[model samples]
Target: MNLLSLLRGEAFKRGIHPPQNKLTAERSIRRLPFASRLVVPLSQHIGKPARAVVRVGQEVVRGELIAEADGWLSVPHHAPATGFVEAIELRPSAKGPWEQSIVIKVQPGSTQEVQVAHPRDMGVLNPQEIIAAVQQTGMVGLGGAAFPSHAKMSVPKDAKVHTLVVNGCECEPYLTCDHRVMVEHADDLIEGIRHAMRATGAVRTVIGIEDNKMSAVEAIQAALMARHIPADQIAVQAVPTKYPQGAEKMLIMALFGVEVPSGGLPLAYGMVVLNVGTLAALGCLLPRGEGLVERVVTVTGPAVQRPGDYRVPIGTPMKFLLDYAGAPAESYQVILGGPMMGQAAASLDVPVTKGMSGLLVMRGADFCDRDDQKIYPCIKCGECVAACPMGLNPSLLGMLAAMRDYEPMGSQYHLGDCFECGSCSFVCPSSIPLVQQFRVAKQVLRERAVA
Candidate 1:
């Protein structure tokens, strides 16, 4: 059966088919020049913030560790470019909070070559050593999760991981960085998979690419053959293209036909999933003994003039990027990631982080005026129900949210299951902002639980 033929039948039910808007899918990745100054947020990852090791006025080279991992949950931060530390103070973060960050003033005429702290041969390292080495590279999910890669690869001693699922499904619209990585970095991807297999003890690896990217599938297959890797040990499988198909649970279902138990993880099903970009970077960095200071980001959307994928340094500010990408001088909305799940930029001062995959700039004229439209009552239309990929009742959840009945929204309605994909909000005829309501409800519930 062809992967394209299985699009509707095999895909998870109730995902919206939004316009792909992949304008720069074919654009090759280009390097973005260093910003005058960069801000390295200590709290970019999900866990404890890294502790700054460099003092103000200290000169640092690219890839040199500026901060140390505070704990096992945290990952160290590396200098994105050769510069002198101007300050280590509070800086604007994408999440609308002031976080402790190391500000570096780039030295003019610096080549910005990465200074490898130490090089290691992966051939002699044991599984534990590989897991330890993953932390040294400062790797994270790269798919917007920002979860530490080392923590994810380290399974409990008693548990057995059967498969390492590689996510090549760049499901989010306007984000082609991952797609470009799959096409151009196939060799690194294969090498990364080998290390991941050894680390997690997965007998085989299955890379799930959306059918829309058949070229990626072919590229990966060719790389596997060129490296003389067997098909059974590593395979590229194209699942149907759908929104949120890049999500771990949905991708697992599309590949193995099994659902991860609710409130549990893919690990519960004896599987571990990693993003292709994350693994590809790991493949290139681990052998060179370098830290992650740069990533491929898709700079695109209507407001962008030179829309393409750029190899962006970790701490490059949004304003610098927008200027380089040739955005209009007029008003526009700049989003840090894709429209579906990305957040509106709080400020252009916020620098790009490890998890940021794309920068989407939308002209004001591109979207409908939300404030101008009146929010009508839901007529109990089943559109939201039909569009929700998680199979939750957005109508009921919205009602509960309006009534301030937050407890039932979670205990009874399973509001915790919502991943905020905005599918329900997109299809709502009443324009009630169902996803926003769910986010507020979840936050309230969490606060109450903490109280």
Candidate 2:
């Protein structure tokens, strides 16, 4: 679990190194005033969409359930603030498309209110009760996956999970949300890890953080000591400073010295990975009997005048959020998540959902010149291959994608294993858009498979 070893660990061999632009790490978490209207997307999580129970023009209280899950794969959606259900219709979202969501207009100047609850001591709840409470709270993976945390904890009957990998590596360039959470709320993290251990039946948990943040590691270590949580059962280990080290596969490999077999989850190797923010929120909500209403989102970039992290309520509008965060309108390109795999916002009308972890407003100076950002032919420099964490030949994939040979890309090059971390594009000497080309190729192959 030594993250800073000059000789890299067993699994993660080579990943590109990008400039870590964590501007908000120095600042503390802040809060923003309630936006006028909040839009809660039903399909924020990965699986099935939640079904809305409230109709338009109906009034709902803060923390009231607006949408409930229809199946085990989905997570419920709760009211972030007191408001009237204005509409249930298609709206702009982070996926760069319109999605069906509940639109609620806040009562002007409504008092900031939260649900009243008693903290059920952690020891009081049994295994099943803890899992039920987590599901009721609408908790999802906050590390940008947005998968239902409850579902993740519910390991299959046959699969034996030996190690619970807690991801603290905010390795994505320009994102410090998880880092800030670990530094500021370390106590909650330990509590969260204990809860996960109870749910998963895992004997031990390992907190894997990148070597970049010595401060975070110190804070987490202090928390474990203060709580008298078994230091050996749950240890804080610093991982190497490399792109894609934050990925579940790479982190599990770094910690256990095992590679996840091709086309398999970490569970295939007896491991279950969860994000620190997701675990911290579980620690906060499950004990208090309160549902998920807000989350700490990183709102920082060069285009932002006052960059910092904020405890933003879910359903907050992107436009209103940027305005409150002092984001310069005409000076930056805005995206909903980290620079490596995040999608750009076609319109600021999109509202924050469970999946929107960071609002990156990068300016022109933070990017290459528009006209100069041209794709060049690869000269076979082998940098992309050397940088690929999965060891796939991006040069070959890009060639196949250009030639419209989608079959060979997946069958021969193992395209399904690529995590799309953008390491190849980051290190390509020819400035070739290797990641984008692979994405296009994968999509085409998937469509063909269904057809």
Candidate 3:
């Protein structure tokens, strides 16, 4: 069946369809010039922070390893530009915490060319070697998770992986970095899929794109055909364009008609899902033996004058990017990713880390209008229940959160299954921040558990 027909036939229930403000979807990615200073944080990934290897006053080239992985779960960090190490000090992070960072001052007139290490022939490498090489590239899920790519690619020996699901669904509004990657870097994405399949011992790979991006599906299909990839080995499938379709569980359901068990991963279903942009980075970096120094980021919103997809260095500050994007001088809110899931930037000085996929700048009026909306008591409305993709009772959970009854929310209501997609909050007539309350409850539960 054609992709359009396939999308019509299959869709997960209970997902809100937000306006896809993909203004930069067709804009080819342009490289942003090196910022005068870069603050490379060691804890960009999910696990232990990397150990700094370069000292203050040391000169480092772009793509040069500046920090080493402290453990198997951690990934190394590389210099995003050729520069002198000015200091290793604490800097503001996107998460509103001061993190240890390596500050680099760009050298005058230095051509910021990446110094590639010896390239490896991926064909000769065993699965273990492939995983190691992926780790060395300092890659993480570029889809805002920042989970280490190598760790994700590594499947346990007992489990068997049958399918490699490549996620090209840029479901978030105002974020087209992944869409642009799928369109412009199709070959690299395909190559990355092959490597990921081999690493995980998957028999076949499927690229699940949203129907809205038929152009991406076409590009990927052409790349697969040009490479003569066998039909059964790889195929592109288009799912419905819905909010949170980019989530691994939802995408898996849409494509394969299977639901990932609650509190389990796609791995439990004999599949491994990867983001297209993440794979594209691995495809490009692994062959060249270069560390991940840059990524394509969408810079757009009401306050941006030059909204487009930009290839920005890892440590580039949000302020510098806003300036490059011609952001308005007046007050504006900067979000590190898409509106629904992305966090508001604590400060403009926060550097763009691996997890950041888009930079959304909204005018003060636009931001405050939403913030000023009053929250009312839940009217026992079933809108949140109807909107929840996981089929969890968000209304009950919200009520539990209100009474500080988090344990029942988790134990009885199956609160762990909620992915915080904000669909309930979006559709709520009371304007209650249901997702926010859920997040706070979850965090409190985690803290209590740890204590």
Models 1 onward score TM values of: 0.96, 0.95, 0.96
- Write candidate 1's Cα lDDT for 176-262 as tens digits: 999999999999998899999999988888899999888899999999999888867888888898998988888877887777766
Candidate 3 per-residue lDDT, tens place, 349-403, comes to: 7899998999899876754346568888999879989888999988889988989
Off by over 4 Å in 2: 1-11, 116-122, 369-371
**Better model by lDDT, 1 or 2?**
1
lDDT of 2 at 211: 90
**Candidate 1 C-alpha error for residue 244, in Å:** 1.3
Model 3, runs deviating above 4 Å: 1-9, 364-372
